[model samples]
Target: MAVDNATVVYFSEQVVILISCGLSFLGSLLIICTYILWPDLRSTPRKLLVFLSVSDFLSASSYAYGVWMVFKSDSVDCVVQGAISTFANTCSFFWTVAIAIYLYIFLVKSNRRLADSWVLYFHVVSWGIPLGITIAAVALGRIGYDASEVSVGWCWVRIQATDHVLWILLTGKIWEFLAYLILPILYILIKKHIHRAHAALSEYRPILARNPQSQSPSSMADLKLTFIPIIFISLRIWSTIRFLLMLVNSPVRQNPVLVTLHGIGNTFQGAANCIMFVLFTQPIRSRLMTLLCFCCHPSRDTAGDGHAPSQRGQGAETPFLAEDTP
Candidate 1:
C-alpha cells in the first residue's frame, strides 16, 4: 500500500513536470529559430546569442528525459537520467559564468586584442572542464556504490551521501552557485558602473554613443540575457529550501515531488537563457528573421548565404567615419 501510494504521487508529479518541460522546450526552439534566421541579429550579438541558444537547447534536452521516465514511472525504461541531470545542471551554471567572465574582460581590458584571446580560452575551459569533472564524479560514485542504485528518473550517478563524498560534492556545488549567481551580481554592478562611465563620455563626444554593438554590456537584446541568471538563481533557492527541510529528518535522501521540480527547473534554466536571447535581443531576432526569409522566402529576403562577419562589417561601418590625417 505504501509503495503503491508513492508510485501514484510520482506518476502525478511526473506528468506536471513533463508538461512544463514541453512548454519550455517549444518556447526555446521558437526563440532560437528567430535568432538564427536573422542576420542583423547575429553579426554583433553572434557569440552571445550562440551561448544562449546552446544553453536553452541543453535545458530542453534535460527536461525531455524527466518527462519520459519520471511521470510515466515504471512503465518506461530508466537510463542515466541522474547523470544527465547532474551534467546539465553543472553545464548551465558554467555557461552563465562564461558569459559573466566575457562581459568582465570586455569591459575592463584596455587591449581588445588580448581580451579577445582570453575570450577564446574562456570558451574552451568553460566547455571542456565540466565534463571531465562530471566523469570523475560519476566514476567515483560507481566505484563504491553510494546507495542501492541511481535514482529512478535521474540520469547521473546517485551515490549515498557519505560525509566525505557529500563534503566534496558540496564544495563543487558552492563553486557552481557562486560562479553563476554571485559572479553575475558582480557583473551587473560593474556593468552599471561602465554604463555610467559611457554616459559621461557620451557627454564629451556624442560619437561615443555610436559604439560597436559588441562593446555594450546591455544590448537591446542583452537585457533578456541579463535577466535569465536571476531565474536560475531562483531555481537554486527553491532546491536549497526543499533540501534543508528534507535533510533534517530523512535518511532516504529522496523526494519525488522535489526531485521532479528540480529537474524541470534546471532544464528550464538552460533553455530560458537561449530563448530569452532570441526573444529579447533585437540583433538576434532581426538576423534570424532575415536568415529564415533567405531560406524559406529567398525571393523576399536579400541576405545572401555568405559569412556573418562580412555582412556585419558592412552594416556596422556606416555608423563610424574613416580614419583622419595626423
Candidate 2:
C-alpha cells in the first residue's frame, strides 16, 4: 500500500505539533508552579529560571494559538500569533545567554557575587529587548513593511522575501547559532579557566585544608547552566539545519520527511528544557519531591527530611544557587 506523502505530512504536522505543544504547555506550567508554590526556591539565580519558564509557557501557548489558527484563518490572528511567538522565542534565547554569562563570571572570572542591580539589569534587557523587536515587527508587518506569514497553517515570519527573512534570520536563526555554536565555545573557554584556577588552588595546601569540604557552587551551577543550552540546541538543531537547507533549496520545504522532522524538533523544545531542568538539577528534583510529599500528606507539618528551610545545608546547591553573592 502506497501512502501519499501529503497525507503523511498532514498527519505528522497535526499530531506531532498537538502533542508537542500540549506537553510543552504542561511542562512549562509545572515549572512555573514549582517555583511559585515553594518560597524556599526563590533566589537570585532562580529568578532567571522563573523568567525563562514564563517565556517557555508563553511560547507553548502561542503554539497552541497557532494550531487553532489553522482551522480559523484571519490576518489579524496570524499577525498576533506571529508576534507572541516571536517575542517568546527571542526572550528565551536572551535569557539563556544571560544565564551563560552569569555562570561565566561566577565560575571562570572567579566572581561569585552579582549585585541585585546587575541581576535586575539583565532581567530588564532580556524582557525589554524582545518586546521591542516583536512590536516593531508586528507593526511593520501590518503596515505593508514586507513581512509575510509563514508556517504550516501556523503564523511565523516568512523566509521567502529579503525583508521577511531578516525578521527570522536576525532574531531566530542568529540565536540558534549563538546557542548551538557559540555556547560550546564559551563552555570550553570557561572550563579551561576553571582548571587553571584549580591548579592555582593546589599551590596553597593550607588554604585547601581549611575548606576541604567547602564545595564551589559556581562549578556545579556552571555545569547545570551549561546543560540547558545544550539541551535546547540539541532539540532544535535538526529543525534549524533543515531551515538552513530550505534557504538554499526552497523546494525541500515540500518534503514530508523534513517537514515532520522540523515539526517535531521545534515543537519539542519547551518540554525538553523543562524535563532537563527537573531531572538534571538535584535542587529542583528534591524540592519537587518535597512538594509532592506535602501534597500527598496534608497533615505533615514539615516537608522532606524535616529540616527547616533556613537550616538546610548550603553544601549542595541547585543549578542556580540560593545564596548567590548579592
Q: Please tell me which predicted candidate would have the highest TM-score against the true structure.
A: 2
Write the residue-wise lDDT of candidate 1 on 1-326 in tens digits. 12232222366666766676676666666655644554444322245445544655665666467446443222112324444545555655666676565545544443435545766665666566656765766556532212212223433333334443363354246555576556667557645655667545332132334446535555532343356466667655545543454345353335665665554564555345544544443344455566767779768644644434444544221111111000
TM-score of 2: 0.76
TM of each candidate vs. truth: 0.66, 0.76
lDDT of 2 by residue, 239-288 (tens): 67665755564556556666666655666666776676655555566666
- Lowest summed lDDT across 10 adjacent residues in model 1 is found at 317-326
Worst 10 residues of 2 by lDDT: 142-151
Model 2: CA > 4 A from native: 1-9, 71-74, 114-117, 142-152, 158-162, 196-226, 300-326
State each model's CA lDDT, in order. Answer: 0.48, 0.60
